[model samples]
Target: MFSFRNFNIADWFSLYRIMAVPLLVAFIWFGERQLFTWFLLISYSTDAIDGYLARKLKITSARGSQLDSIGDQITLVMGLIGLWFFENEFVLANYQLILLAFLPYVLQMIIAFRKYGKATAFHTYLAKSSAVLQGVFILWLLFFGPVYWLFYFMVIVGVLETIEEITLIFMYKEWVEDVKGIYWALKDKRRLKKKSVKNPTS
Candidate 1:
């Protein structure tokens, strides 16, 4: 599923994030804060670019979705670790609030993995919003400092996005991608039952 030989340009972008992990960690180990933040920003930017290119070029696929989701998680985890390393004071102060958002995100991943043997790639609108806010918050904190309002907002959206993800996980028996939200899921034929051929019931 992750074969580089068959990967499209968008998939290659996702692969780039995965490939950059060691370099990113090396920056941290070397105490290169400026370099790490700039590189992290580039990682986040690749996320947006890959997603856009996938949609625009119609190269979206199950493999691509899975790769993209993995890349996003890896990048986000790296961002948070960068936050902890460079901004230890802020993390120490807000560990409770951060977990309030993070724990449920972990739970959602657990639910998806248990059911599908992998993480979801719903890529819902709420998920996109949360990702953007999270990327912005992490970058802003690393570049300047934490903003209280943004932190609170990111937490709220993160929790809400988790709830929506859990619901969607239940709604679809099979792994799926690019779900917009619960509303669309309700009308999704994928979630509906097959009609009786003879009865033809609605």
Candidate 2:
């Protein structure tokens, strides 16, 4: 997956996020919150750009989807680590709320890996909204501080997205890429055809 020879433009953009991790960590190590936040913002921007380019250019593939998800996961973890390190007081005060929002996400990951042996790249509408809110909230908190309303909204959307992901996992027996959501999953010809193939008599 890390093979440079196999990477496309979108993949390279996705790769940028992973590559930025060490630099982000260094910013934290040096207590450079401003630099870290700006770099983090750029990393998040690449998330949107890579997906847009992949869809616009019609170069979407399973490998690309998986790679994108991996990059996103790494970036998110780094963002959270930065948040914890730089905003230790806020994190400690709200650790319960944070864990409340994170537990289900961890469960969703476990379920996906158990069932599909890989991470999902559903990229559902709710998931996108959640990701956007998360980035916004994280950046806002870093730049300013935690705004209760934004934090609440981000947590809500994140929980909803995780629930949707878990539901999608139960819906699809096989690993699929770029699923929009449960509604689309129900009407998905690929999934339906696979089901029929497995249960021809049904």
Candidate 3:
């Protein structure tokens, strides 16, 4: 169902964000402080640009939407990991007891991807807020150092996101049906394209 590669600015912006994932990974893995910070800013800029382009140009597509979700996850995950690498004690040292707290996230991601065939529910405000919260938390951690109170703040935000996704699964069971419909539509388009190629005048 991914279909947003038609020179749309929104698509370009989304791709820009996705492309930064590698640099983020490298920065974290290699511990490049300056490069890491620059990429982080670029990543955030990409986020803002994509959203702005989507709204201003009305170029939102299924592929663009999916890319947005993936971009959010990758950016947050990599950013947090990078922050962890740079500021280890603040992250783990402060919240040692809540280490297993992320187990739920792992399970949730599994269910969201495997069972639901969705990286995330696209239309949820909570999902967006969760991403923003994580981004803010990472920036704050980097600039302000470890603030233990942020752990509780993140816990609350994360819990809301968890509940939102879970509730959305149940509330919108037809999401799978919608995906099936999209698949069928794409299949029809391909068949039409094949027929056109085979028969010059149909």
Give the per-residue lDDT of model 1 (tens digit) for 1-202.
5567899999989989988899999999998999999999999999999999999999999899989999999999999999889999999999999999999999999999999999999999999999999999999999999899999999999999999999999877778888999999888774444322323753
Best by TM-score: 2
Model 1 lDDT, residue 156, Cα: 98
Q: Deviation in angstroms for 171 in model 3? A: 2.1
Lowest summed lDDT across 10 adjacent residues in model 1 is found at 190-199
The order by descending TM-score is 2, 1, 3
The CA lDDT of each predicted structure is 0.91, 0.90, 0.65
Off by over 4 Å in 1: 194-202
Cα lDDT of candidate 1 equals: 0.91
Best by lDDT: 1
- Say which prediction, candidate 2 or candidate 3, comes out ahead on TM-score: 2
Angstrom error of the Cα, residue 50, model 2: value is 0.5
Instruction: Return whichever of 2 and 3 wins on lDDT.
Output: 2
Model 2 misplaced stretches (Cα beyond 4 Å): 199-202
